[model samples]
Target: MIIGSSERVPLEKCPALVLNADFRPLSYYPLSLWCWQDAVKSVFLERVSIVSNYKRKIRSPSFEMSLPSVIALKNFIKPTEHPSFTRFNVFLRDKFTCQYCGDKKDLTF
Candidate 1:
C-alpha cells in the first residue's frame, strides 16, 4: 500500500517485533520480526494483539491505526522438546562466559 508522503521514517524501517502467546519474543537470536506489510496484514486478520505501537499512523479510506511496534500471537505454539542449536543459544547456555578460559569479555565463536 502507498503510504507516508510527509513522514520521515521509512516504512521499511518500521518492523514489528513478534511475540508468543505468553508475551515472550518468538525468538531471540535473529529476533522474530515481521515487516510493516505483514504486520499490518496480521492486524487486519486479527492474528495478533498489539503490545506497543509507534507514533506513526497509517490511514485508509475506511480506517486508520498507529503502526505496531510489537505484537503477540493469539495462539500459543508449544516449544519443541529440544531447543534449536544456534550460536546465540549456545552463548546463552554458556552464560556468555568463555567455555575454556572462563573469561567474560570479547567472546567470539
Candidate 2:
C-alpha cells in the first residue's frame, strides 16, 4: 500500500517490517521491525532480500534508493520453539519471588 506524504517523509515512519526467509514475520507478538538505517545496511550487506518498497526514497552522496517496507532474510534462521506454559516456567520467570507478597522465604502457586 502506498502512503501519501509531503515532499519529505519523516524517518520514524520508514520502519521496515522484518520477515524470515520463509516470508513470515520474524516475531509476531512484538512485530519485528528495523529502522531505515539498519534496513539499508542489511540491503547493502546482502543479508536480506527486499520484498516491497515504500513510496519515499532516501538520497545519499553516492546513491539513492527507495526505502524498503518489507524485507526477508537471505538465509533461513531456525525458529525457537515456544516455552511450555507451565507453573515451573512461570516461577522461573518470576525468579522464585512472590508476586503478591514480598516474602521470598516461601514461594508457591
In terms of TM-score, the best-performing candidate is 1
**Model 1, span 1-109: residue lDDT tens:** 3233336888899899999999988776779999999999998899999988887888899998889888999999776788888787889999999888999999987
lDDT of 2 by residue, 37-103 (tens): 9999999999999988888888989998888888999998888798667776777778877788856
Query: Considering summed lDDT, which 10 consecutive residues are worst modelled in model 2?
Result: 1-10
All-Cα superposition RMSD per candidate:
4.8, 6.6
Off by over 4 Å in 2: 1-6, 84-109
Q: Can you tell me which runs of candidate 1 are displaced by over 4 Å?
A: 1-6, 86-109
lDDT of each: 0.86, 0.84
Pairs with backbone N, CA or C atoms under 3 Å apart (clashes), candidate 1:
none
Clashing pairs in 2: none
TM-score for each prediction?
0.72, 0.70
